[model samples]
Target: MDGTIAATSKTDARGKQKDKSPRLRKRSGFVFILPWFIGFLCFTAGPMLFSLVMSFMNWDYMQNMTFVGFANYVKAFTQDPFFFPSIRRTLHFTAFAVPIQVVLGILIANLFNKKLKGKKVFRALVYLPCVLSGAIYGLVWNNMLNTDFGVFNYFIQALGGEKVEWLADPKITIWALIMTAIWAAGMPMILFLGAMQNIPDHYYEAAEIDGAGGFRQFFSITLPMITPTILFVIILQLISSFTVMAQVLALTGGGPAKATYLYSLLVYENAFKYMKMGYASALSWIMFLIVMGITIVLFLSSRKWVYYEEKGGNI
Candidate 1:
């Protein structure tokens, strides 16, 4: 009886130690991430919470805040004339730019995947534009697309075509911006190339063995396999497109007639240029909601289209 009791005590102590081991490890893990947690709370969550509160007030930096409680939001929706136009312009740019970027990225990535001569050089050249500073990109394009004495206009004139105002004409300015966006498809192209290379060679070989042609194999195998990367790129590009301000600021400065005033640019103008802090905060929250809604819709829609290899099915 004494021996049995001693053994039972030892076992219980061992079990207790085992239980404490996990708790200790968890505490250590939390300690390791404590700095990041504190940073997020102080810098990210704190500011967002403050912004939410500010959105309800009527405050300029020079005066005490007045608690308006949704007045700013109401004004933005019903009173502000530029609000809707900015939203529309942002949406217009996003709609035109994201799809073209995705398609071009995929096409270029496919070209890079091919075992062709000087492919490395071509790949590097394609990726070069993505590294250019946005301000520089905008300035360069501004000069190149100028109506008179621009490189593009010179080429058009040489080809016996009329000089077109690429940036000045409101009708074509957005299109020109879209063209500029397409040039920076290098990031997505590289992602797609990585995804393509990860696909097993046997799959292509099997498709060929089954009498499948190149295009058929690409559509049926390559596209479906790379759908996850496509979804990721689409979400990122969508967010970036909506928040685009630097290029517009550097190139058009909200345009000749405010035709290129994106939502983010409008926010910037209100925040800094006009010093309407409360109103800008409200606008930012509205833009946040819009972005969240669109992202949620995309995620929900992706369930039918995005294929997950680990899950062995579409997600």
Candidate 2:
């Protein structure tokens, strides 16, 4: 009876140990991510909450705090003349730049995916621009796109075309910015390349066996498989384009008649330069809402097109 009791106690202890193992693993995982959670709460969440509250109050470093309700928001829309134009310009830049970046990224990625000579060198050249500082790139392009005596103009003159005022003319400045954006398409290209390489070789092999040509195989197999990556790249590029400021500030400084005045630059001017903190906060919240709305729409639409292998095709 003593031996049987000892054996029963050992069995219960073993079962308890087995139950605690999963709990231990979960606790360890949470512990590993605790720092990130704490940082997010302290830095990100804290600032966002503070900014939300400030948006409704007339806040300035030099002035007394006054609760203004939605007056700040109303002033942004009705009183500020630069507000709507900035939004339009930002949207225009996004519209042109994102599509071009997506296309160029896909093409460059496809090129890199091919088995060719000097492939590593080509890949490095393509990715090199992504590492360059945005401000530095803007400065370099600003000089390059100079109306007279710039390399671009020299080439145009050699070809008997007129010297184009790239950054100086309001009509052409936005396009110049868009061109600069296209040049920095390296990140999305690298992402696309990674996604393409992850696709199983067996799929392409099977397509070849089915007498599908290269173009047909790409359209039917490669594209469908890479739709998820495309969606991710689009959303990321969209957000970046909308929030673009450094390049615009460096190159055009909101430019030849505020033609290139992005929404971000406008917000910065109001907050720091103009000392209109409340208005800036309102603008920031508006931008937040716009970005969130677009992202939500993208996510909802992605369910129809974004393919996932685990979901048997799309989710």
Error of 1 at 13 (Å): 19
Off by over 4 Å in 2: 1-31, 311-315
Error of 2 at 112 (Å): 1.5
Tell me the tens digit of each residue's lDDT in model 1 across 250-285.
888778688787899989989998999999999999
Report the CA-based lDDT of candidate 2 relative to the real structure.
0.87
Which 10-residue window in model 2 sums to the lowest lDDT? 20-29
| TM-score per candidate | 0.90, 0.89
lDDT of 2 by residue, 184-247 (tens): 7888898999999998999989989999998998789878888989989999999999899878
* Least accurate 10 contiguous residues by lDDT in model 1: 20-29
Q: Candidate 1: lDDT of 252?
A: 82
lDDT of 1 at 46: 95
All models, RMSD in angstroms: 6.9, 6.6
